[model samples]
Target: MNKDEQLKAAINQKLIETGERERLKELLRAKLIECGWKDQLKAHCKEDFKHKNTLYMDKIMWTIMQFK
Candidate 1:
């Protein structure tokens, strides 16, 4: 892996081992909700999907996973 990728992997592993990953996720979720970004994103996504005839569940899930 490249240096940046290796550093990211190490940091992620450390976070996971220390149980900080879940805590960070919770904090991020709370911050997004507090800032109304979560609701705005949901509304924007819903609006985009409303115009589409085919909604791919996997693609939608992948997009959501990117946020997580």
Candidate 2:
């Protein structure tokens, strides 16, 4: 693998071994909920579903990134 990929793998391995990844995920979830980002994302998803009658993850994320 390239140097960048190798560095990413090493960092990910350290995070996993130390359980920091899960902790960071939990913290991010809590922060999103606290800031109403979770609710906003849910509303956006529901609105998109209503208009399209189908939910596509890639489309949803793209729209969300634009919205942000």
- On lDDT, the candidate that comes out on top is 2
* Deviation of model 2 at 23, angstroms: 0.5
lDDT of 1 by residue, 1-67 (tens): 9999999999999999999999999999999899998988787678667877987999778666665
Clashes of each: 0, 0
Give the per-residue Cα lDDT of candidate 2 at 33: 98
Residue 16 error, candidate 2, Å: 0.4
Worst 10 residues of 2 by lDDT: 46-55
The CA-based lDDT of model 2 is what? Answer: 0.88
Check candidate 1 and list the clashing pairs: none
Q: After superposition, how far is residue 24 of candidate 2 from its true place, in Å?
A: 0.6
Residue 60 local lDDT, model 2: 79
RMSD, each candidate, Å?
3.8, 1.9
